[model samples]
Target: MPDISPLLALPGAVAGAGTTADHYGDLVAEQRMLAAGRAIVDLSDRGVITVTGPDRLTWLDSLTSQSLATLDAGQSAETLLLDPNGRLEHSIRIIDDGVTAWLLVEASQTAALAAWLDRMRFMLRVEVADVSQQWATLGQLLPVGSPPLVEPAAPNGVPLVWHDPWSAVQVGGWQYAAEDGHPAAEFPAVEILVERDRLAEVGVAARAGELPVAGALALEALRIAAWRPRFGGEVDDRTIPHELDWLRSAVHLSKGCYRGQETVAKVHNLGHPPRRLVMLHLDGSDALLPGHGAPVLHEGAAVGTITSSARHHELGPIALAVVKRSLDPAAALVVEVDGVAIAAAQQVIVPTDAGATAGVPRLPRLGAVQRPQA
Candidate 1:
């Protein structure tokens, strides 16, 4: 993870500490060009994992939250690993190409995830290995109507390209967002995994002005606009799929029991999620953007924390936060950035009543009996 990207040497490349360049001087123009499929983002900070053996699919399906038993070759999917109490642990972007299943994940998470998968192999025919040293990941816009700007790597006879599953709800997924509008489909991303040598060639092409390179910040802006909840930004020890409306993409409600299946089922079918995710439209008059984990204040009361924030090309300053589900959606909010409280307007992502979908009747405690569902 020691700044592996060759694009770091590009002109105007303001490389982040131990990460890729944040921008090529102008983030706005970077976003525009990247969104048009004319540029690519250096995602070298991400890591790659590969699973092989005939039992790979079922082994993964039995261990994670996705229904991967039927995942077809060349098909794209996503899955999550959770603690026993159903807290967010790791989010994986998956693509299987018959012979091997490729996993793209945060570099910080690669070692732990691979180690855990290795421990769980227990008599199974599957073998897990961290192949990050042998591969490179690059991200680009591949919206539905257009062709890819560059081809993906398929060293094993199938390209290791993972389409963003957030584009639509999966078959076993359920959506709890109160609003009908979600812009996820507009940000069609395809993760390309190439051999290390091939990426070196891309770096050469980039230096020759043949391959336009946009920084990770540009892609992050578009991701924020799409209302996508990234594991690195939104996920925490207490995060549950229900809180982020992640059920819309990552969770398979009906999948066979995984480690946290009970909590996931109980939260979705019989109880409400304790918190809901919201988007805050910040007042940019101060020209200050709140960093991640900034305190979200509702009338001077610390109600929640900002997870991710970005200045969209058109929307200006915006952020995603998780707040108490009971808080009024119309409530005016403030985000404190370095002790300066910035006024923010709230936009709903998940509603106050996002769960209990089973509609099971609840009985009153002791003498006071509640009415049953009719």
Candidate 2:
């Protein structure tokens, strides 16, 4: 199994579970149950960081792209950390519990994000710590029953539940998708924090069928179906928020200056992103799904590569890819998987004219003489 899931059966998923956690033995059923809000995803392997003190909110506001100063307690917000040139460096899922702001990130991002925050705190009264050792995370949809089987509690007085904000655009955000039929509304996901010591308890409950459990495979498929963009999966060195339709939630266009703000602003106000995100519906006749980094080709020429690929229970083989913004939206394409070319039809997520939101008009050329009205 790989980092995603045995649920996907990408390479060895048919034999072993993927890299993260348990395979749960029944991926199909897991997908069905999880999508229906009857199951929970085991995300204990992810990372958790905490920011403390009175200046935590204000300090964070000055550093990240989102307006965090006014973030209310128990509220969910997503923000991006980009380089000076506006390329994605980190994606932070934030939930402030009044006293402490809990930063949920991929396990691989814990050390780097903590270190960056630590170095940026000059005189502000703030403290950052990677508390993954003490805390764990679990994901699920809104409860199917009247009452949730597991209630999230904050032992430290800060509520531990972080409702996902990807279901809709956030304040000070912009959306680039030209259509309104996005399935994001179907993904009412949330993350809950629990003490690491409770993992054994949760496992026992799951094993006894008192609660349902899912794996990365089941969870990721639902994400693809919703056309959601993730951190490590959908992001790359050249990635900017506009390219992924990430501005819908992870970016604040009007927020004051932060690292990469210039590029974000310029791209949205005067230019289009170099690349755009799209969902590829792969041919499933072979029952073989392309893995990450698989080549997307037009006329046998490489145009882009698949970021994340999965075999969705309902949608079959699907993937997210970043292709040239100039690629024709209606052009037929193909994805290469393990030396075989799989037919792929694109479903546009971000449009070619995604940016230039400011609508700046073009000026006449400097060397060209002004012409009279024809």
Candidate 3:
């Protein structure tokens, strides 16, 4: 899992699932330190893949959901690799530095995703390499609208700072979340790429109280509060960007042909996504957090499934669930966690009528029947 033995030696550090730290003795204090920008989270479990060659940007643009053909140096964007059916396969945090495109993704996805990309590079000039072993990730809270402050630039001179674009809609993107007061409006966070060998330095500093360090759990809480859809947690084999409001940042509606662009356009224009995403405020009377894949029930019938849940420092228990689009927007739901049903109130993230095409002209359906009386 990325060999976090260096961090495990630190006081209060506890091993967490999937190469993460569960907490640092006091989770609440760790979260507070993170929110206040006094601590950073070790995200060594994340992976990095670098693509080089002259055709890198254009080749990638032609394949993924985002428009990357014109990406400039230091530009950051998120893209989705979709299957032929438009199901999400991979979600990449992209940054180009004039020479190479660095794709940051979940650690578990690194090997498979890299292998897939390598096979796709048949005649193209692009060269893909998994650089995860050499690079690690660090995350921290930042002031809203502020950039990450990294002293020494990445070896590629790219800074490798992904200032989350979730705060606002990009030029060619759309937001399905409530626009008046999106939760992500105040969720300021960033992930910075650092040398893998240097993680020990960070751990030492954190233990000495020089550089405050939090656990991945704190970051999860903040991400859930922001209604952010993570790749491994919120996505499934049937997931489309439309279902998770991912178009808000990842997809460019007018982008040219890609593998799954047809479905993207079709659903966005005339059809609604089969499922919709919601933020659930869980009843925390029992002080329990629903597990991922927990069944979300409406009137005792399964209507959705919780993708991720967390106990926020301030927000108590919160979760992101994907429910059937036909379900009532205000339906009172219950999440079954470990055989215990917990009350859940929905906060609309993807509206019931999300993906409605406003002005797009409709065309007649094929095979019109003409019945004549003889």
Best by TM-score: 1
Cα lDDT of model 3 by residue, 55-169, tens digit: 9999999999999999989888999999988999999998888898989999888999999999999899999999988888788888865555434246666677777778778
What local lDDT score does residue 226 receive in model 1, on the 0 to 100 scale? 84
- Write down the lDDT that model 3 would get: 0.85
List the global CA lDDT of all models. Answer: 0.87, 0.83, 0.85
Off by over 4 Å in 3: 144-152, 359-374
lDDT for each residue of candidate 2 in 1-374, tens digit (9 for 90 to 100): 11332223222223223234544677788899988889888776688999999999888888888999999888999999999999999999999989999999988888999999999888889999999878877888764233344677686676688888889888898889865798888888888888777766776777666887777778889999898999969998899999999988888888788999999999999999999999999899888888888889999788888998887888888999999999998888999878788999999999988998888788989899998999
Pairs that collide, model 3: none
- Note the residue pairs that clash in candidate 1: none
Runs in model 2 deviating more than 4 A are: 1-19, 143-148
Put down candidate 1 lDDT per residue, 320-368, tens digits, no spaces. Answer: 9989999998888889887788999998888898899999886668888
User: lDDT of model 2 at residue 39?
Assistant: 86
**lDDT of the structure predicted as candidate 1:** 0.87
| TM-score on alpha carbons, each prediction | 0.96, 0.93, 0.94
